[model samples]
Target: MMGLPFFRTPEIETPAEIEAASLRSDRFRLQRQVDWQRLDSIVTALENGRPRRISDEDLLDLPVLYRKTASGLAVARETSLDAATLAYLEALVQRAWFQVYGPRMGFTGWLRRFVGGGWSAAVRAIWLDICIALAVMAAGTLVGWLLVSREPDWFYALVPGGMAGGRTPGAGAAALRESLGTKPGSDGLSIFAASLFSNNTGVAIMAFALGFAFGVPTLLLLLYNMALLGAMLWVFADAGLGWEFAAWLSVHGTTELGAIMLAGAAGLHVGRTMAFPGDRSILAAMQAAGVRAAQVMAGCTIMLIVAGVLEGYVRQLVGDAAARAAIGTGMLLFWLGYFILSRPPRERET
Candidate 1:
């Protein structure tokens, strides 16, 4: 007992020690109080949408004040400042940092940029991939038509049972024609649209996602999808409803198929970069290609959504073949013009 004399634990802070800490914190705050307050005010004005209230001089001073406050926080952290001072500085530094270096634009601004030129720019950046994908798709369609023409059995292999939905190879003209028309009830149109959207989205995603496998899978996917289209076309053509089916499909197919091509191109772009990295490492090339491809894929998703709407509602409501063709043609032109004519801000300036 004598050997183990009572000793004060370092964990216990005495009242006088607490008071000294408080004084040190107060003195530290006083030294940097003005800069901290200035940063807080600027941040407050920005957060409250009162940027106009801030003066030009204060705006110019913002970064400097932010750096000073951040430095103060570091010092406080290192010196074991009072908890209250540390907490205040932490909050103030976080708010200041956001105002100083956070995102320059909101979602709406980003969307406007994307729609105006970002999407089109991304699409243009992968023009080579788009060309290759288009060729592959056309070849695939030809192959499907040739296979089904030679042997009706190939239709079952290309088109799924649910998709065929009574529009099989040997189906009568009346049945095939009826299949092209809208159903009697309108209640299920929403569900139908959603289902189509989900299905098309899945195909688009697969096409885009499979590019990581050196793009072979993506090419195959695109070919398979176009072959399905070819199979369907053959079915309708065999019954003399080819033009009718073409019109029906065009109402949505222009957009949907375009989206698929873009997705395929995105995948191919990734694959091509990986295969031929040039001076850069394969990983670096893939990263660069991925950014552009992702942008194109995003646009493809929007296109797929539009296609779903047109397929579900417009295709159903519009029975006239000419009108449907006109709509589809107009959409195709719109996309072409948008991608071709729409220039980025930098390009426009130049």
Candidate 2:
């Protein structure tokens, strides 16, 4: 058949004989499993100017084979050839390559499934917690602000102990502004990690702490915290310190405030369960509420860490007003899109 020892036998046939043999083989086939798309791809490769044309010498690099059930013509063992198969063999190799790897990883199909599943799942929990808690907190804070403005001293006393550096409201506001607008703080990462842990723990404690009030105290505490945020923000804005407040607060504010509200909501849930005790016993209701609240707060803690990072590092590092605005807006959009636009895995029918 050939000079090469590997060319075990010669396959001599006229074009008419080859066609007739192909027809006979096709008649008894279990299925027409021809990989024609791969042939098309092989053609495309040639059209694109492959470095070298396939030649008889190229057959040495490829494994030559014959199938009894298929046509008795020689075929390449390798699915993809290295610019060296004869035109006919090149066609065969391309078809095999396409059949093996081509159908599985379609880019368009992959992207659709990815957006439907992975990305959506990653952010959905955080989004749900944010939406539900934020709306409630906003309302509570507004009411608290109205209540506290009439009695300023009482409101001041409600703030928890251990503020950073004992800075006055004015001084703290300035520092916060500086912190937000300046480059990354020296201990920004540490601050973020510490604040997130502490803040989340604070919410958990708040939920536990308010238990003493038979739940009213917890509601009051949350309302008080919200009022303080609203009033302080009002003060900052009135002093023409809007950007600084937004920058300083939003950096960690998103996570911290979000966590706080979740905690407060947890407390409120406990209180409501006890207050109503609809069909279930008071103890059972409280237990159920606690478990759900724990889930929500746990998610909130994660949000705090992310918020703290942005607040402590990214927010501070980006000094330009426009940059701060853009980042803040992006975060807000992310929160909104994740929660509102993205559907949960549970909602999707399997």
Which candidate wins on lDDT?
Answer: 1
lDDT of 1 by residue, 126-180 (tens): 9999999999999989889889999999999987776666677888888667666
Q: What TM value does model 1 have?
A: 0.90
lDDT (10s digit) by residue, model 2, range 292-339: 666555555566668767755676566676666667777767765764
Cα-based TM-score, every candidate: 0.90, 0.48
- Candidate 1 ranges beyond 4 A from true positions: 1-12, 55-57, 186-198, 347-350
Per-residue error (Å), model 2, residue 152? 7.6
Flag regions of model 2 displaced more than 4 Å: 1-136, 139-180, 183-201, 208-214, 341-350
lDDT of 2 at 168: 25
Worst 10 residues of 1 by lDDT: 1-10
Could you tell me how far off, in angstroms, the CA of residue 24 lies in candidate 2 after the best superposition? Answer: 73
After best superposition, candidate 1 residue 153: deviation in angstroms?
0.7
Against the reference, the lDDT scores of all candidates come to: 0.83, 0.51
